[model samples]
Target: MSQWFQLGLQNGNSPLMEQLTFFHDHALLIVVLITSIVTFFLSAIFVNKFLHRYLLDGQMIETIWTVLPALILIVIALPSIRLLYLIDEINNPALTLKVTGHQWYWSYEYSDFNDIQFDSYMIPTNELEQGMYRLLDVDNRVPLPFNQPVRLMITSDDVLHSWAVPSFGIKMDAVPGRLNQSSLMINLPGVFYGQCSEICGAGHSFMPIVVESISSGEFLKWLESQI
Candidate 1:
């Protein structure tokens, strides 16, 4: 969840999200270093009005410029590639969850369990209780146990939509007639919020996503109740 005036990424609740945050910080540091160095050099040249044709165009300087960017890109690309494989690696999920996007709502199916499915709709403002977040609360929140890997399958019944939960580091598109897959394993217990990221129709902003991360025992209780 985010606070007022907050612009940074949300604190991670999953291992993948935590790794993503680390990568973001790592890349940001390198970017700032490059920007600062470039700015200083430009400022020095402009302030002194110094011009040395041979010194500026030296072979050593050219080689350094070319090799430095390549090194930086390699440094960035390695981790990115590793993370991509990690995210795509869905090995023997403990459970399977299917998410279906509609024009104005979402449907969830716990495929591993029998008769556990429901449609999630946004809680209207007039029906909201005290302390409930507006435009983020749903009538039925998808509950899954923490520390358990779940295979997430996403698809759309109608137009394009996106199922994104920032704290969980999930943002998979829901395409019609095609299924996209992802994985989620929350490391903590909390209620995470999200919304339909793609603009589908008039109710695009009204379709909110809520996920309840709970202990295995509590999750079993909820599962039993749902079943």
Candidate 2:
């Protein structure tokens, strides 16, 4: 979860998010390097007493400017393409969780188990308990076993709503009459929070999403109770 004065992005709980964090740092470093080089040249142009006419027109400078950006793009594009493919690949998922977004709330279904499904509605601020996160907590949470890959299928009931969780690096749109799917694995065990990113209605901010990640043994116990 993100907190006040957080320096960088929230801790990544999924493998894909970890890769995303790495890619962010990698790209930022390149941008910083480019900025530093440009700044140094601009400073020299103003402060330095020496001036050369050849500096303004040169094939070497043009080649450097052109090839450098292309090379940098290739360097960044390779990893980006790999991550896209990785997110798309769903390998033998241990479970398939179906999600549907309504005008305000979210519904989840565990098709791998028999008749296990529920609606998750946000807990009102006035009804919140001590130590509970106001406007972020929900009456029901989508529970899943940690360290196991799961395939998520999403759709919408009425309007467009986006199911987003920052830690999991997932933000799938819930479009009516259309379905979207993604693969992810929670590497850590904890409760993660999100909300309906799209403005479906007036209650958009009140529609929150929660996920509780636990071990497989505890998940089985929860399944037994649900059954």
Candidate 3:
């Protein structure tokens, strides 16, 4: 199962996106597992008591209604809280990238490098490929090494915008005068696509994000090209 999880996405080229897709696809399984156990027992109790009971909407029914929902909430809260905290915690990251949300585009700067910066804009519709999505391509691609930990610092040049790449399990707000951070670790080499999530202006939908994950050697070559 772990081996299968490492496979790249059929629609996307990124391995990180594939893992996120799997996580999204299996998310309902967790819901099903918990709901099945809780609902089955609860339904059984409801049917056995309500269908054959002597009274309807009585004191016993009222008491069961109040207590049953609270009990179910407790069961659901345990797992939900654990996942929330886990997502918030940041481990040691190998490198960092700074992303700034501009008025109609995005700028990424490599903090680990010599602050190599580039602007990413939307790909013109005429320039799009068969498999490529328009408004999701960029003029520049952020390059990083495969199978490495990377930290991202996000901020805004104008209004607020959200840097969200669903495949990377990253969504950080880019607020004016403030910086937000997130981290990612890709286990394979490929191009991952994302877009500016917040609605800052008319061109908000046009601002796309493309991240190129390459081999360590290839990443170095790309970095040298930037210089």
lDDT of each: 0.94, 0.93, 0.76
Write the residue-wise lDDT of candidate 1 on 39-59 in tens digits.
Answer: 998888889766888656799
Model 2 over residues 1-227: C-alpha lDDT tens digits?
99999889888999999999999999999999999999999999999898776688999888988999999999999999999998888999999999999978999999888899999999998899998999999999999999999999999999999999999888889999998999889998999998899989999998899999999999999999998
lDDT per residue for candidate 3 within 1-34, as digits (tens), equals 1124665334423344554565545656667876
Show model 2 residue runs off by greater than 4 Å: none
Off by over 4 Å in 1: 49-54
User: How well does candidate 1 score on lDDT at residue 72?
Assistant: 100
lDDT of model number 3: 0.76
lDDT of 1 at 120: 100
Better of 1 and 2 by lDDT: 1
Once fitted onto the true fold, the runs of candidate 3 whose alpha carbons sit more than 4 angstroms away are 1-51, 54-67, 129-131
Query: Candidates ranked by lDDT, best first?
Result: 1, 2, 3
Best by TM-score: 2
Residue 20 error, candidate 2, Å: 0.4
Worst 10 residues of 3 by lDDT: 8-17
Output the TM-score of candidate 1: 0.97
What does the lDDT read for residue 216 in candidate 2? 97
> Number of backbone collisions per candidate, in order?
0, 0, 0
